[model samples]
Target: MAGDLVLLTGSTGFLGYIILTELLKHGYRVRAAVRSQTKAKRVLAGPSIKALAPTDEQLSFVTVPDMTAPGAYDDAVQGVTYIIHSASPIPSFGDGEPPAQDQLEESLVKQALKGALGMLESAHAKAGGSVRRVVMTSSTVAVVPFEVYMGQGTEPDRVWTSEDRIPVAPGPYGFEFQAYSAGKAAVLNASEEFVRTRGTAFDIVSITPSWIFGRDELVTDAGGMRAGSTNSVLLGVVLGVKNDAPYGGNAVYGPDVAKAHVLSLDPVVKGNQSFVLNSMMDWEDAIAIAKKYYPDAFAAGKLREDGKQPTMALKWDASKAKRQLGLELAPFDTMVKEVVGQYLELLAAEEGSK
Candidate 1:
């Protein structure tokens, strides 16, 4: 198992880089699929990846410029024992205006579906004899309906689980989040269907995580640390940036989610199953956690206690991940400390530099 080769997509992304490091740490050889050689170089030069110092055999790169293109992964999947397809389009949260409905559908929904299906097709056709499993990176948004996640109508009284499935919401999606949610859900459903119907040699293990947050070692500067990742959504709370609508209080530590993906690769773990990874979190808890751990920051006005991010609790049954993957999901306190602690550390470094 340690020597087996794994094909990993999205090695340059937030969660993907963590997964890449975890795979190397576990002794699995990685063939990281990057969009370009530049991205591969960036990932290799990253602090976390450089720390591992993976050699050519231990880590390699294959450029698949367009994941949605036909036969995109045919060459990359060869001889690999597993495929971790984490590459997906993310919504832009910048100052620019949101894309039109067709653009959103093309970028978020269509691209996601095609990329996922194409990977599976390649593995099945080219590497079916070698590839034993595919651990896909899904999200809690896939399992939770758009209406429920947006807090639009009556909230479901029941706790959501990996077993739950939501019908794909048709576009003209109102915003990026909704379109992104639809994309994840579509990929999950389509992937399952493909495996179930095709009877491919390999099985699928879908990991559905929510609001992943933790130290992003790839981030080098203060500005990058402040707004570079999903951690930013949580960081915004500590910095007193308010969300127009409260984000659901569902989250999982980045490493824990990464662990889920890596652990699922073991043959002993059941195949063709979904795992929900999350911990219920309160938005305001970040302030308390920060103040309790770093009183000087709040005293110096570097961290605020007057943030207005409201918590919308969304219950999820995540016990299966712990029992099945033998993962102890980090509690909200741990998540808050890690995220806020990293921000403060970066801020201090920046201030010291000046």
Candidate 2:
């Protein structure tokens, strides 16, 4: 995507900030479409971000005018060769049980898709043609459901992937991972349909990420909660780091996740391209990294004493990403440290504000 001016929809988010920083690091000029240009300024102040923009000469910011309206990106679609649709709803640590937490309000998967589809429409209406590609931010929760994994073979209450392994309107129970992944799966399904029948000229790809932990440019909201901030599993451990909990979830570095998004958008999906970043990891790895860099922030919590063995196929086939993106993920030690360090920084900042 070099020499290309990409339009980013969620430039003020954690992953968005990292993605923008990465894009600018690679010399890709950006048009950050966010809700508040004012808040966008603070987000760009992160050391990592400031280093990318250097000066706001080529960088541009625009308040996404009516993203849910008829054609939000219609006028904003000028000169942008690529679209990085990275905005989505995420929850702070342990904040739960709200109707919004269901991804309808926070994730806004459907509305975002509508906006994305509208962009394709808006792009086609452009004088030249539709945007060349639309890169979406999907969650790993979409790839596999937690209930299925948790049930495995023993928890008779477990469910399994269906023939299509896709979600339907009357789909499986909406557990946390299931619902989140289901939302992403729905968007990808929609994207594929739109591209195949309506806008073949526009390429689309989905980058699914797991528990993302890293430094953030987006400040804590007025409520003091932010996506990727209040991780229940981590918090449970952080709350219980004093104890040992055998925990293993697909945790990756934020920067690596951002890099995966860029590489996935390289117009190579039909070419068997993949957008998955971060290989699977187990509890000990997270514990070691947490202990080294954030002894106070992380903990080795006491998990189900199922011998701490990998419950199921806790791996994802990221071979395509490696082959296509040629990306080398940061080491577990480095990635975990960066994530824990960020959590601590967030904790300190929150305490100071109080």
Candidate 3:
């Protein structure tokens, strides 16, 4: 009965779209919350959703455009027994001429915190009595020392546990990455704050997934999808968008991350908790896997071998996710193969269309 009826926000996002299919595959009835019901239907009716064929009377959509609006999710969670709050405002560069760095950081942090609090407060008021669990899609930006790991600053690497403080502010400003990290950190802090004061009406589990790599089924074959910065690293490499730039980290397969969200709904789980998730592969290893598996892409110069490896490598402790959620993270090579292979197919489709 845990999967009987669930309300899922962010159904239109890359991760949320995948999570939708994963939930349906697990036999759950999902009430997708999207900004536009028509757009959601159009996007979902494509080959990707058709391939999955997850249609059911229970699989429906409700419009919630302004997630930050007061009582936004109140009606959405009316009859739902479970919730997966994956919908967070991903920072974008916008049309042209980037805004002031401080302003961008402030806006993103505010929006992220507002959206998170909206979902938490709504769930507490509307669905608290009956909702089983709320699984939030937090990012590794909330856990790892990205400023230190990425060499963006001189901050020393701190021992990061679920209880560690997330520093997203007070100096080390000016970069979009830092802004995004601050936003993610704000969400995590907000989740803990909600749990501590709100008591245990419903269990909240926040999953902090590192860079997610895999073919995005929702994106077109021409590779014009608006993937997040984390995913854009690999996709950008494959599409020649950032051929010379090497980016890598503790990466995880996108589907594996989705599967973790589904697995977190076990009834035995209780209270509030957070888990870091990732595959044990750095950037160089992942690229090697791509070149080995999809030689054609590499040969065509679309997938370059010139990307740089990280000077300061970092490792993630995903044992908590494996232990608590029973999730066995996918291998680096396998995920690389899947992502590259799928990109190749998309490229071919694009060429055929032209």
Evaluation by lDDT, superior candidate among 1 and 3: 1
Q: Write the per-residue lDDT of candidate 1 for residues 303-333, one digit (tens) a residue.
A: 8888878777888999998898899988888
Q: TM-scores across all candidates?
A: 0.96, 0.78, 0.88
C-alpha RMSD (angstroms) for model 1: 1.5
Whichever of 2 and 3 has more TM-score, that candidate is 3
- Candidate 1 — worst ten consecutive residues by lDDT sum? 93-102
Worst 10 residues of 3 by lDDT: 239-248
Query: What is the per-residue lDDT of model 3 for residues 76-194, given as tens digits with 9 covering 90 to 100?
Result: 88877789999886655332345477676556677778888888888888774778688998887786555564566544354355555566665336766667787888888778888
Question: Cα deviation of 335 in candidate 1 (Å)?
Answer: 1.6
Model 3 alpha-carbon drift over 4 Å, by segment:
46-48, 93-102, 150-159, 167-172, 225-229, 238-248, 309-311
**Count of clashing pairs, candidate 3:** 0
TM-score winner between 1 and 3, please give it. 1
Which prediction has the highest TM-score against the true structure? Answer: 1
Residue pairs of candidate 3 with colliding backbone atoms: none
The lDDT values for all models are: 0.89, 0.60, 0.73
